[model samples]
Target: MASQAMKITLERIALFQFTPTHCAQARAMLGWSVEELSREAGVSVEAIERFEAKREVLDVTRLTLAYRFEAEGLVFFPGFAPGRGMNVKGSTPNPMARADFAMVE
Candidate 1:
């Protein structure tokens, strides 16, 4: 079951496209440098810079980068409708956290 799920994920990732802006945004949200992302994504810093500059990268490289970013809590939303973009999971305040804060106050 896990292998099947991973296969489906890989298939989806193969078809997904990421823009330079999305990469930049995700990096900024994580406060990660190009070198840092390169290390995590197992790609070269030069490749990351070129992708950001040209808004183009090989599908495998792009998927690698995306998966790396996602592993670090970044969620990528497909541009199927409005408000399509990346966001950091748990970056927003949760109700439980808010309640804890209220108790503290």
Candidate 2:
């Protein structure tokens, strides 16, 4: 059952992928600045800025951001409908202690 769910989640991720809006929203929810996210994700600030500005950026860069944020307890949903967005699982991220998020769609 869990594997099935993971498969569906992977499909959804592949279909819709990640967006700049999602990145900005997740970063805002986590109270992280571009510089903070750059340091955390090991992505350059210019790349982060370009991505957030909806400009062209490398797929690996975006994937790196998504993966890093996911590790920090953020779950991303890809769609325009209600409930199709990001949410922090378990609890909000804390600098002192990390939260856990499940990869299920």
TM-score of each: 0.59, 0.62
- Cα lDDT, model 2, residue 79: 63
Best by TM-score: 2
**lDDT tens digits by residue: candidate 2, 2-103:** 997985576457335567888898788788999999887777899889998999876557666776666676666666311223554322233223122211
Q: What is the lDDT of residue 41 in candidate 2?
A: 72
Give all candidate RMSDs, comma-separated.
12.4, 7.6
lDDT of each: 0.60, 0.64
- Residues 7-98 of candidate 1 have per-residue lDDT tens digits of 66764653364566678888887788998987666677877897779755565566566656655655655662112235553222232222
Candidate 1 global TM-score:
0.59
Pairs that clash in candidate 2: none
Against the true structure, candidate 1 has what lDDT?
0.60
Residue ranges of candidate 1 with Cα displaced over 4 Å: 1-17, 79-105
